[model samples]
Target: MQRLTVFLCCIWIGSLMYGEMVAFWRPYWKCSWPPLQQNLTEVPHSHEGFKVAVITDPQLTDYTSHGLTPGSFAVKAIQFFTDIYMRRSFRTSLLSFEPDEIIFLGDLFDGGPYLSDKEWKESAERFEHVFDQTQRGSKSRLTGIPVHYLSGNHDIGYAGFHSHKREVIERFEKVYGETNYRMKIGSVEFVIVNAQTLDGSMNENSTSSSWNFIQNISADANPLPRILLTHIPLYRPNDTPCGAYRSSPIINQRISNGRSGIQGIMYQNYLSEDTSARLLDLIKPILVLSGHDHDQCTVSHPTPNGPVIEHTVGTFSWQQGNLYPSFMLLSVSALSSSTTSNPEGIVSTNLCFLPMQTHIYLWYASLFIITVFLLLSWPTSGVDLSYCFRKLTELAATAIRTTSKGGVKVKDEDANYEYDMVWDAEGVMHLIRKGYSKLSNANHGEVRSSARGTVVARPAAKKQTTPESDSSCVQIESETNLEQIPKGPRMTKGKMSYIVQRLFRTLHNIAVLAAVNLPLYMMLLIKDWT
Candidate 1:
């Protein structure tokens, strides 16, 4: 039993410590762990598998008010604390994934609606600093990965609410290029759409042009596996609201009338009733991806072409509903051209949630486990609970007195100052005394000399005492005098067993402490990273 206990403790301690070290190293340096791979429906075309990192709703901002006023400083201070350092963390995590390409599905800015002329320019500059390709002799957070940006409700405008002017749309297009565009990578056609356009918030001409482009692409004689990327998900599928609907199903049902009573930005943030059906019929996109709800979810709908799967990726913003920052890694295999009727190649997607808050849960779990282990492994004979409590109280008092004096103060009376006495279950009262200085100076030779022949004499107490109690109460003559003390009796078989048990209990306590505190301490060191 002892061997097994020791072995288990070693394993637990080793695992906890190793996890702590990795966690500590992760925040300062990028993690080297491989990205998780998720498998999708297999396509008929033969092609090599490639990785795509999908990040959304970073909503990056300096967070200060858009004015040159005194209050801006206060607002900036508040925003500083609230900012999750999304850029730094995102870069670190993305580097770890080492994706071939990155696709950001919208809401790249939080204060887009409030931006002034200067603020707009600054926001554009900040966006480029964080996401744009590296220039000559410049540092780039993205290394060499190609990035595709999409416009969400926060960027330009939704539909009817917080609508942006035509000039604002022009500026966005100028910076990020056409919001609605298509790119062919390998045998796959990625269709990027501006959900804002569908809401009738943008110029009708631009919207019409995009629609025409999509139609033109769909008319291809040899179409590839189409994947659509947008900001808002299709109108609530499987009765699960992913867009601007209220979190509660009952509330959503009450508010969602025939036309969806949601007004303005919220309305534009979600698709209209027949929006998905129309898009599905037009493009026949097998896979559709979106973001803007900040909720990670997946739903499938059957169409004339095949099954269309829609996924809403989670957010990296703490300002949003993203309690834990996360992103998706998409793995797309090469398309096989054999018997191609728009080959449905397998596209695997893994939603990788960051382990930022995992340490908190692990700390709580470790504490609970340590408490249980201590209770079950405590030495009952050598350590008395009441005695331990008393000792702890006395130690606290001594510490308080020592701190007040700036150092330990020694009393003149008999070198050892008596503080208090504690009576045990055996009716034997042990007088607690302290003579820290002399105790430290006394050597083993002195202890042996004192034990050999020294005997102490003191005034007899004015209380009844038994013969064994009198023999046990041999008072010390001086500070160095620690005469042969009575420890109840010699070591018998039972006493030896008790000693061995206490030894094991001590080891158990040490092991349990290591298991409980190592990870917690490491977590404290990294809690400020993100």
Candidate 2:
């Protein structure tokens, strides 16, 4: 048991040290591992160097207050906590990357269809607080950073339907301004396309306008390296044989209607393959950034002009469908100041997956329980109780001894009483024998001193000495010392308590290791140690 305890102790201590080391390198852990590094040699741009923080499908929502039914508060509380964590993590990642600007590629709110005018304003306020740095009284972690917003099907209904009403669109415009806008950073031009409207879901006229806008940008007289920013990725050739790009959102009972049943066959989240191919041909964009599917993917579709690359980033929020949280950082550098005519520049994109340490929660909970158990498991001393029991037994034996002298005795029917008394009496006798040995040694020493020149008979000296009286006196003295023997037992009890405390501490450490999955980290530490 002792050896096993010591070994577990070492593991526990090592686990703590390992935890501290990881915490110290937390920033690196948050950004670097599981990173996708790609140099977009196809992208044409020019700059000293600029970084764009690309995050998609934030889908931020306060689901806690949504559908307020019985026992919904717990779900709401959890959602609230998750929202806070995700927002903070997103902000931290952006700051870590030090992006010049940020692009939120849609579904900034989960219930865009259901949001009232007031709710829309509130959601917009939260968006500004989390993502926009210029807003006053904002909790924006990044200052002086500009953010571009894109509209997803969740924000407004699909192109071919009125499921998302015009009033909802009006509310959205009040907060985020126009859905489709353009911006130029460095030598590159970014054209934001409203995919929801581009699909002709609201009206044919809106679709025609979006198409015309794309055409105008594609036919720019002095076109720079143009990039398309939208919420849905263009369909790949293999997405489906018949023409739809991918599966649609699950139609649950709450949102299902007369027109919703067969909608899965016509995916609302993805653009048509034909439209995608046409857009690629027209713009001849080097890179396309999009997000609607929570999965991260990069697909290259061959166009008549060239191959257009679409990089879809994963969701940064916590949800049932979100497998892992991720974002992309696009870096652009200018070839030269005079490269406005020749806007081909170096572009590198790194897709970063945030570390998801879900096991740490379990580890913390386990440590707390173990600590509480150890505190309650403190060793207790039963000295007073044992001493009282011993005194009672001694008294009973003394009564029997005194009565035996009179040839009379009380009936002692307790079977174990006699056995216990016998053991106690034997212990007293052993002490008496020890006292006698000590007295004998003292007498022998005195005889040796008195008879240094002559041989002295130790037996004669023993006989001359009245050892009966001496024995009686020594026995009384021994009894007095025995009366104080409880102190020795008390010291022994303290030693036992100390041992128990050490054992509990060791157990606590082991519990922590088990909580944190010690074996995995132990291997990591060993590898690093070597």
Candidate 3:
């Protein structure tokens, strides 16, 4: 029991150290910047493309989920821990890659749309805390990099649904700037669209504004290659694959009829096919980046210009369904001259994964269970538990003797009576027999007789029970039993059985540990490879 306790303490300490100091930062160390066509080192500083960190679907926790109730300790604890996990990942990524800009692909909060004004403000504060740049020191990498935000269905409800109130949209815009806008960072132009409004099922005014924004951007005859950033992904067939890095193999698209379907206000998998086509046609962007499905997906949409690639980035928070949270790094550079062969300079992307938080917790849990099982089932040879108990009783009698000397009376007869009562109540003799039977064969049946004799002899002490007297009696009885016990063949067989049991136990424990942890390791390795 003592060994098991120490083992558990060591495991607990190791888990805490790894989770806090090592796990969150290890992935970033393993990941490198996505390579460009022309080596970045060879290019001039002005022409070297900028790196953008694309984070999506963080979906910060709120009272609506995780069985969290308002004003409760559990809710506060969960929120704090979750926010810290996200903050650590973000900070580590910034420090590792030092991206020139950052983009949040939305679903910033799980209950953003439905939260009350006070609740909404609190959630927004948590969002700021998770992505805060001001707190980081001047020496920090990516110290003043700009971060852009997009509106998600969770942030502002799906357009045309009853949940899509004008006030909700206004609240989001008030805090996060305009939902539909365009900006140029480095040499590439990025068009940020509120794809939720493109559904056109409701909120006519907002939907109209979104369309106008798209039309205005499309009308501009800019020479720079355009990249579209939106919260919802462009529509694709239900059978579309989300690539090897996606947690789920298939992307299921579910569309609902206006106000008549079982799907609630929150059920949107992708943009409507018509809206997708309209955005593709008007924007005519060279690339599209979106984040609503909370997983990595890459698909190509055909256009007259060429095939436009759309990459849906995965979530950034571990609280979401994804076990391995990740973000994308996009390297974009502008070309010096426009040509028929290649008008754009270069754009390359790579998905960098975060630690598997769920798997780490599983490791801790599995370790505890394995430790407990081994401790309870471990083989012990010739170590008598009853003898330990007898020693404890003798110690108690010695303490009582000292107390009696100091003018406190503890009767010898009473002590003996109490000891016999505890021994019978706990069935110590029965326990000894059961323990010995595990290691002793039929030839070692005499061990059980010796254990029974020890118990019977204890009850015979009716006159006076003292530590010295009990110790002398037990020592003489033990010696006699040792002399009478046969030691040649029977003892040799018991020793061999004990050795075999220990070997089998060790092998079984190894197999169990491998079964529990091998798949997790394989998954991390495979994801790293892809």
Query: Highest lDDT: which candidate?
Result: 3
Evaluate model 2: give its lDDT: 0.58
Query: What is the TM-score of candidate 2?
Result: 0.57
Q: Which whole-number lDDT from 0 to 100 does residue 308 have in model 1? A: 82
RMSD of 2: 18.4
Q: How much lDDT does candidate 3 score?
A: 0.72
Estimate every model's Cα lDDT from 0 to 1.
0.60, 0.58, 0.72
- Give per-residue CA lDDT, model 1, range 1-530, as digits (tens): 34435555565555555443444336334333232222334332343467788888877655433343533775565444334245434544554566778898988776675567677787776665554344412334446778888987778765443333556667778777788889875456789987766745334655566577767876888777778998977766345644332232311211122235533333434677576677778777868998877767777768887678788887866556556666787766554433233323346666666544444347657855774565456546435658889999999999998999988664455333222243433345554332232223332211212433543222221232222211233343334534665355554766888767767676666666567666765563355332
Model 2 C-alpha lDDT per residue in residues 1-530, reported as the tens digit of each score: 33443454565555455442443234445553222122345334332367787888867665423555523676556555455445545554456555788888988887676667666677666665555343223445557777778887677655444333556666666777777778887556788987876555323555667788888877777676778888987765444222122223322112122255422212355677677877887777778888887767677778776676677787876552654567787766534324333223435566776534344445656755655554445334313657889999999998889878884644433311100011122233211211232223233221211111322222222212212322321211213446656687789999999878767665665575465656665565443322
Could you give candidate 3's per-residue lDDT for residues 1-530 as a string of tens digits?
Answer: 34444555556556655765578678777887786666445466666568888999989887786767786988887776677778878875645677888999889999887899999998998788678765456646556788889989888877655333679888898988999999886667889988877776443788778888887877877556678898989989888877788786667788655564522334678887888888888887888999988778899888888898899988998888888788999887744324212423467788889888788778877876777576546545434679999999999998888887994655554332112111332355421111111122233222123433433323221233443332321222323446777879989999899777766665665555456456654554333222
Error of 1 at 488 (Å): 43
Q: State every prediction's TM-score relative to the real structure.
A: 0.56, 0.57, 0.67
- Name the lDDT value of residue 191 in candidate 2: 82
